[model samples]
Target: FYKHMLGRKVIPADLEAFDPEYFSNLKWMLDHDITNIVELYFSAESDELGQQKVVDLKPNGRALPVTNDNKHEYIQLMSEHKMTNSVRQQIDAFLKGLHEIVPPELLSLFDDKELE
Candidate 1:
């Protein structure tokens, strides 16, 4: 469907079968904060070479998303433990910008405190 929608040739079914090697790299990417699926998709579509170019660019994964109920508490814990400056900045930005698109009460669930 994706290839059809985009007017690109569909990858063959034999190739589409999940390769063990691909999964290993995919797992590494997931574990090490490498680019998520959405970012990968955007990068792939943005280029004429699609996935080939996206693979070359190698966008890193975003910082983890905050799931807890208390934003202030999460921030305090991260600050107390001396998290990286980049993580700290991401957290602060989320706190400031979260309420803009989200209901204030629901903001905590979707916000990535460490996302820049």
Candidate 2:
């Protein structure tokens, strides 16, 4: 009696009827959702830890200029810790000028507040 939805084409009988490019789109959306969820979970976990996750890639470096390589590194770190845009930009600039100047203790400057 109620196969009529499909019979009347209210809904497609095949998965592709819902979305022609189903699998690819579904996978992309799922991956994005998972990433967002993971970021949220990590953020909550970090709040519990009372510390932001830090990655010390370079050792004993002064004012570093934000280079393309450093930008890439910054992006990697940002994604890992879900860093903020302002913080990412600050770090990026620091890296870009690092060779010419010394960077202040970033963690100290951030004071437990880093952009995501």
Candidate 3:
């Protein structure tokens, strides 16, 4: 999915590269579906700087619709597991910033509760 969505082959070196495309794909995953898999991938790649890169690379405009049919299950699973303080803080800050620009009708799509 990463390769297909990103329009590039992800080589082993890509993981360490932390290139713009790599972070862009991660943002794609997060915006398309809020899933544990996305969270795990983000967490594994996350550093203070990396998190900022992901946020900066995220798409602007209306939110993408959730396509995963099992999205509710994923949300439940995420809520069941406790997030580290750092991750929580990152998410909180991201959502707060997002809410400021996202359209009012689209705000529900990014409800922080569903992401938590």
Candidate 4:
């Protein structure tokens, strides 16, 4: 961070990275009811735990299967979890440290993409 602080580009925002094709397939499944929706659920690993443990997106989320009607909500929840909730603490910590060097007010100068 100290090194980057002096660079031309100080703090570049991290973009939400995802595979387009995966979503394309999801959209296709949503369109075609005939297409069998694969069994899936919103889940993640418990990073805090040393042993492998599953983290459900929400209460009873794991027990619930992804069906046609609920698939839309599933996708949305998945995206939200991955983009925001998953790394929320990490993002906050990073920004807190970053602000010590580069003020948050200065970040307004660069757009989200520009930060990258």
Best by TM-score: 4
Q: What is the lDDT of residue 105 in candidate 4?
A: 69
Q: Is 1 or 3 the stronger prediction by TM-score?
A: 3
What is candidate 1's lDDT per residue for 1-116, written digit by digit as tens? 22221222322231223244543443444345332332332111122323323211123312333332322333333222222222345555664665566555553343232221
Candidate 4: segments with Cα more than 4 A from true spot? 1-36
Clashes of each: 4, 22, 0, 0
Relative to the true structure, candidate 4 reaches a TM of: 0.59
Candidate 2 stretches greater than 4 Å from native: 1-48, 52-65, 83-116
Ranking by TM-score: 4, 3, 1, 2
lDDT of 2 by residue, 1-116 (tens): 11211112122223233345643443343334333232211111223245654333334222333343344443333233323221445555555665246444432343211421
Candidate with more favorable, higher lDDT: 3 or 4: 4
**Comparing 3 and 4 by TM-score, which wins?**
4
Cα misplacement distance, residue 70 of candidate 3 (Å) = 23
Taken over the whole model, the C-alpha lDDT of each candidate is 0.32, 0.33, 0.37, 0.59
Residues 1-116 of candidate 4 have per-residue lDDT tens digits of: 22232233221121123445655665665676623647677675555535766778778777877777777767666655555565567766777788898886687676655675
What does the lDDT read for residue 73 in candidate 2?
Answer: 42
Q: What is residue 99's positional error in candidate 2, in angstroms?
A: 45
Any runs in candidate 1 off by more than 4 Å, and if so which? 1-86, 108-116
**TM-score, per-candidate, Cα-based:** 0.20, 0.19, 0.23, 0.59
Assess candidate 3 and give its TM-score to the true structure.
0.23
Give the candidate order by descending lDDT: 4, 3, 2, 1
